[model samples]
Target: MFDLNTLVRPNILTLEPYRCARDDFKVGILLDANENTHGPALSEISETEKFLELNRYPDPHQHELKQQIINFRNSKPNQYSEQPLEIENLCLGVGSDESIDMLLRCCCKPGEDKLLICPPTYGMYNICATINDVEIVRIPLTVPDFQIDSNAILNKITEDPNIKLLYLTSPGNPTAKLINVESIIDLLKRSSSKWNGLIVVDEAYIDFTLPNGSYSQSMSTLVNQFPNLVVLQTLSKSFGLAGIRLGITYTNKKLSKLLNSMKYPYNISSLTSNVALKATTKEGISIMQDYVKKIIEQREIVLNKILDLKYVGKNLGGKDANFILVEILDKFGKPSNEIASKLYNTLAVDNSVVVRFRGNELNCFGGLRISIGTEEENKTLLYKFERVLNELNA
Candidate 1:
């Protein structure tokens, strides 16, 4: 029998999560949770007299928000043409960070069970595992291309039954590479019975891959076909709602229920939920799509400009994300951490422009990860970068 309970930690299986005071009733002149009945002391700024319900607890289920997400996902045209996901297949977290932490807590027993990660990827996975006291197995991606060493990953998982979660960041961090969908499918097929684990694909930058607003590259729709898959997405990157801290996990209904049950009763605040609803509306999506198109265009421009610079070396990995990774080279045209560090510091300190120095990451020595910004911002960055390189060389 295929049982999810067997994979979950014993403590988590019997865990009785905290129920907030607002659970019993939402509408009342409620003195239920010892909350102050008196409204805030601040003066009302709006002439229309709008209240943010600061005195009350937000919805525990976030039914309306999940419905909005479902609508958003279904609206996209995907290669799989999978069935539209209902609320049962969705769960919201503060950000993908929260969801990562939750998954580690629910499935992996502290100090006993393990989570596997392909580094030169998201750092949060490793950090979350450490925080939860869960063991982590590192399988670094193949250098240059930044592709997953599928055979090595499979070998590690097969050898150790303790690994309960495997994290793969699509359009990866720093590298900006997309792991092939066929490779993922092959891994899924091989690990089906041998490994009773979840494959968590973080698609935080998937929006950039949608050049024409198509979902052809997203593995989110694969959740229906692969029961062990959980795709994590966020409003932070594309939708420009980083401050609201809204993240989503799309998975099978059973896992969704468990995640929801384990999460804080009211994980999302009323204000955040309301803003997210507005952002996910038809008009909001159109605006977001237009912004994404502009970003992709800017990314291309930045990539070409960087390549033209004498100090810049190989453009590592696939440039699918809104960022590009380029190595900073010495005068002799070799990757140099010293040169990269100097350039990064000069850009930030002298030029008032900053790009991430990824020189310390594996296989990314002397690398700088530059995010695609607005046209004016990109031009400023390029100009600053050119001046900095000339100064460093001089």
Candidate 2:
């Protein structure tokens, strides 16, 4: 008999991934991973040089890349602090996904410990936890607003001291809610006036929060005071370098070095590092900000149109991120999986139109999560959505 746990890690022996990229056709020019296929593909000479590096092993310690991320985030060394955060507090991994898994291995023991996740959040955290033999305790967000509940979270953690990690998504996935900063500060202060273990804050969509990141920009500064807190930022969403597969974690020196030591060396490639360096360069920030401004403008236009459609119920979130989560209803108003199914089948006929039906929703079961694309593309989705809604109503 297969000693199943040995083949796959104890936690991951049986795991189901988010149904992203249902097939190759759903993956547009490899954008599913947030890569820039438009990035310069190799010229003849450039191709030859890159091929040479492929022969040698990647740099075990991603030194050059770590320096680049440190400079870009401007962590510490602000006007308030004379000393910059030590370089040892920083390291690079294959992507934020890699960091997520690595941290679980470093902290959570197999089969005995548990991790907490607030649902309608990122799926990867759950996936990583299960594979590590770590049990997942879910705290579903209440309806209408997908806000975090500090009391509920604390109660669960207090009950299970085995809770080693708390995975949170800010500008949360699908929902787009920037969790209350004060609530997070309270979490840092939870228990004996404090807590420990890993707290991974995924800021994947922080770029999309608009009118200048009004809600959560200052929340990150808490890292300096909390030794257990770790923030995962990625070039994927904001820097437009998701293709580089570059993700960053901001934590104290002790945790950072431990994560670095545990990961496979040369996890971050030279090509990826070079691209990430360019992605965060001063010039790059200007371009990214420009794109962000356009996307936020486009996101608003899309939200208004979604509200206009009879099929879409109230938008699910507080409306601060690039994408919006809205409910889809049937004629009798029972949870409408059929309507979402139709949207997927119709849009997928051609790869141009793609919106995700938030699947297996426990609390927000009938919603669809839509990303704002080009002006024309947004209109295409709106038009198709309205037609489908009218048809479903009939």
Candidate 3:
């Protein structure tokens, strides 16, 4: 018999994704992935009701929605003043997930190619790279705060010219810290002339960083300024349209064409496109801004409550986004894997609450990536945590 392992890409043969609902469906008013709490409503749909055709294939170009976001981001001034980026350099996706898959297909050569990733970050980059048979070179954060060491990345890139893509998550997963705008800019400048591949900036959480420390001011502007840059933005977060599965990738025209070609012909359904359009309205998007601000406020509350608890030790929060990465301590003052396991069971069975835990392998992020729920859920978590604290203390 032929060797099957040889036939299958080594990276792809053993891949696992985090266990969550298959799609966006989770608990009430999802803020887990930083989606807007408010969902879509058809207040202005009566006029388009008759024209709404579900069976027809959506415009593969996505001319209208792309321009809508372009205008929303105030990107008109870069292109023709009146025309405002009608097409070419911008493309939409089913979600950032599909956009990620598209990039791997378009760029990476199986086995020979590589992608640079920084972890205590999103896992999808690893998942997609593995599926594509692309090697992933991971450079973890230098410290517990989860800041990237650009020098290490630059050194690695110099050694391995095969690095075709770089995947970085801002306000990174689990750690919930901003991977320094200045750090990214410096890296881009040092590597741009030499590294001719792609730098995909995942701005899924950029919305939450509004009014400060975002690519909107620094790196997003670089897309128009630099040819090698690609900004991957998702309406799932700020637009509250996770259910619609709409995301945008911004780059120079050449790369944009490649993504358009490799992507599924109708990656975004008609329903998804129209829903995304509504979800990204002037008023609706602002609502998300307000909503994220509120969630951040609640995140502070949750962080404070957890920090006050004697069982809770140092946490991974404070830079950006809504989730808190908190470490639980044991009586002997070692890692709280046992306590966390016990608390997870107690919270589930006794308190009807749930929290996540990371293993020692993910040493930097070995704690619950506790999302800032609504005031009620936050309070309930606090209550459940307090009970666990009491049990542990005794």
Highest lDDT model number? 1
Q: Which candidate wins on TM-score?
A: 1
Put down candidate 1 lDDT per residue, 1-394, tens digits, no spaces. 1258798777777777678667766776788777767754557645322466666667888888788888888767356646777888988999999999999988998889999999898889888999999988999999878888989998999899899899999989988988887788788878877888988899999888853445667777678777888899999998999999999999888788888889988789988988899899888989998999999889889999889998898897677888999989998888999999999988999889988899999889999988899999999999989888977887
> How far off is residue 304 in model 3, in Å?
1.0
How big is the positional error of residue 107 in model 2, measured in Å on the Cα after superposition?
A: 0.5
Q: Kindly list the per-residue Cα lDDT of model 2 for residues 100-165, writing each as its tens digit.
A: 887788667799878899987888987898788889999886566777888898788777777778
Query: Considering lDDT, where higher is better, how would the candidates rank from best to worst?
Result: 1, 3, 2
Worst 10 residues of 3 by lDDT: 75-84
Query: Candidate 1 at 309: error in angstroms?
Result: 0.9
Local lDDT at 271 for model 3: 76
Where model 3 places Cα greater than 4 Å from the true spot, the runs are 1-50, 75-87, 213-218
Which 10 residues in a row give candidate 1 its minimum summed lDDT?
41-50
Q: Name the regions of candidate 2 deviating beyond 4 angstroms.
A: 1-44, 47-54, 75-86, 192-195, 211-219, 332-335, 350-352
User: Per model, how many backbone clashes are there?
Assistant: 0, 6, 1
Model 1 regions lying over 4 Å from their true place? 20-24, 45-49, 211-214
